[model samples]
Every structure is written in C-alpha cells, then in structure tokens.
Target: MSSKDEKNLTQVTDKISAMDEPRRSTMQRVHDVIMTAAPALKPRIWYGMPAYAASASAPALITLRNDERINLALTEKAPFRAAGGVDGQLMPAAWYLEDLDDATETRVAEIVRSVVG
Candidate 1:
C-alpha cells in the first residue's frame, strides 16, 4: 500500500471505531472477515464509509453502509457475482445484514476467498 492509502486506512479504522452501537461492531467484524478472507483487499474510506478495494484508489470491492440495517455491498465491478432478486433486470448490488452471525461470516468468507483468488 502507498503512504496515502495507509493513512486513509488508518483514518477509516478510526472512523469505524468512532461509530455508535451496532454499526460500529458490525463494521469491525465485516472488516475482519474481509481482511482475513482476502488479505489482498485494502481497507479504506469511501464516501465517508468503510470500504475495501482491490488496490489503492481502486473502486471498492465491498462497502459497509449503515442504513436501516447494515449493508454489505458487492460492487458491480467485483470479480464474483452475487445472487439476489432483479432490479429492473439487473441483480441487486449488495447483501444486507441485521447482525453478523457465524453462518453469515462463513458465507462472506467463502465469497471473499473465491473472488480474491
């Protein structure tokens, strides 16, 4: 990672640490799952939210959004495809989570490993 990226990752981590309640804990776990599953993905902040990318300044592979629920979005440009309902003929861009259970973590890890390979 570049110096800029390292700085940004630190900034992103700080932001995650500062978040309130479930979002904070959820994002941290998501961060860990992605990093552990795919060490090649670099953590950063995108649009003021936590995101992971294939490289410095690249578009996010997955992003954590604190909406009505926690959202783990797989970018359209990402390597592996996600299965879900269609949106005007296009697949939905992400997976939503109310909580990170063990099953969810395992599935997320499996996706990350497949994509990062």
Candidate 2:
C-alpha cells in the first residue's frame, strides 16, 4: 500500500475504534467478513469509513452509514448492481443484501469471491 493509503486505513481504524462498542463491533464484523472472503482486495478508509476493492482498481465498494443502518455501496460502474433500491432516497449510498442470516452470509461470500477473484 502507498503511504497515503496506509494513512487512510489508519484513520478509518481509529475512527471505528472510537465508536461505541456495539457499532464498532458491527463494523469489525463486516470488516472481518470482507477481509476473509476477499484476500486480494485491500481495505481502505474512505470518507471516514471502511471500503474495499481489488487493490486500487476500478469499481470500489464502500460501507456507508444511513440513519441506524450500515450498507454496502458497490460502484455504479460495477459489473453487478443490487436491485430494488431507488436512487437518492433515504437509502444508503450503496446496497447490500438486507437479510444477513447464515444463508445471506454465504451469499455475500460468493459475491465477494466473484468480484475479487
């Protein structure tokens, strides 16, 4: 990683570490999921939050905050886009599968693999 990217990741980790435990834990869980599933992708801090992509390539994915929810933002330029959410609504900057149950986690793993592989 470049010095700038390292700085950004450090800033993100610091900000997340400062959050309350519940919120921090939630972000950590998401981070763990992304890192484990997409080893080729690098995690970086974007707009004070965590984002991952295939090593500074095009099509970045971001984790964004919307009200009480956290959502993933896959670039509009991404080959695959999530369906159903309207643009510029109260929706998050990106779309992620709503039900993160065991099945959903597996699906998320598959999606990450497809994108990063």
Candidate 3:
C-alpha cells in the first residue's frame, strides 16, 4: 500500500476504534468483511464514516451507516442495477444488517466480488 493509503486506513481505524460499544464492534466486523472480500477497495474515512472505494476517483462502493444498527451500502457502482431506483426512479442503496449470519456474509462476499469485478 502507498503511504497515503496507509495513512487513510490508519485514520479509519482510529475513528472506528473510538466509536462507542456495539457500533465499534459492528463496524470492525464490517471492516473485516470488506477488507477480506474486496482487497482492492481502498479504505478511508469519508465524512467521519468508514468507506471503501476502488480508487480515489471512484465513488465508495461500501460504506457504514451505523446511526442505529450496522448497515452496509452497496453503492450504485455495483452491478446490483436495482440501485438508484428502477427505470430512472430514485431509491436508497443500503441494507440494514441485523447481524452477519453465515448466509448474509456469503451474500455480502458475493456482492463485493461482483462489484469489484
């Protein structure tokens, strides 16, 4: 990893480390999954949130939305074309993860691979 990328990951780790309870634990799990599933996605702290993108120019394909529970956003960049609404309608591109069950984790891995591919 480049020094800049390392620095960004460090910042993201620090932010996640400082989070309170379940949020911290949840984000850590999400981080692990993303890092393992999509090694090419650069980890960074985006607007005080943890986000992963393929490159500096590309939009974040995965981000944490933990206002209440752990939520993973598979951004519009992915082949999950249903995003941003069907036939030009607008829609949210996030999924509320109650927990990382085996099936859910498997699906998440598949989605990450699809997005990265």
Highest lDDT model number: 1
Worst 10 residues of 1 by lDDT: 80-89
- Candidate 3 residue-wise lDDT, 38-61, digit = tens: 899998877678888887656787
* Model 2: ten consecutive residues of lowest lDDT: 90-99
- Error of model 1, residue 86, in angstroms: 11
lDDT of each: 0.81, 0.60, 0.77
lDDT per residue for candidate 1 within 1-117, as digits (tens), equals 779778978987898899898789988898899889988888888888888888887888778888788888877667644454653445545778878899999988887776667
* Decreasing lDDT order of the candidates: 1, 3, 2
Q: What overall lDDT, based on C-alpha atoms, would model 1 receive against the true structure?
A: 0.81
How do the residues 1-117 of candidate 2 rate in per-residue lDDT, one tens digit apiece?
A: 788657756776776687775667766666667778977676766555677756654446645442366576655444553444564334323545433566756766666665655
* Clashes (candidate 2): 1
Models 1 onward score TM values of: 0.83, 0.65, 0.80
Please tell me which predicted candidate would have the highest TM-score against the true structure. 1
| TM-score, ranked from best to worst | 1, 3, 2
Off by over 4 Å in 1: 80-92
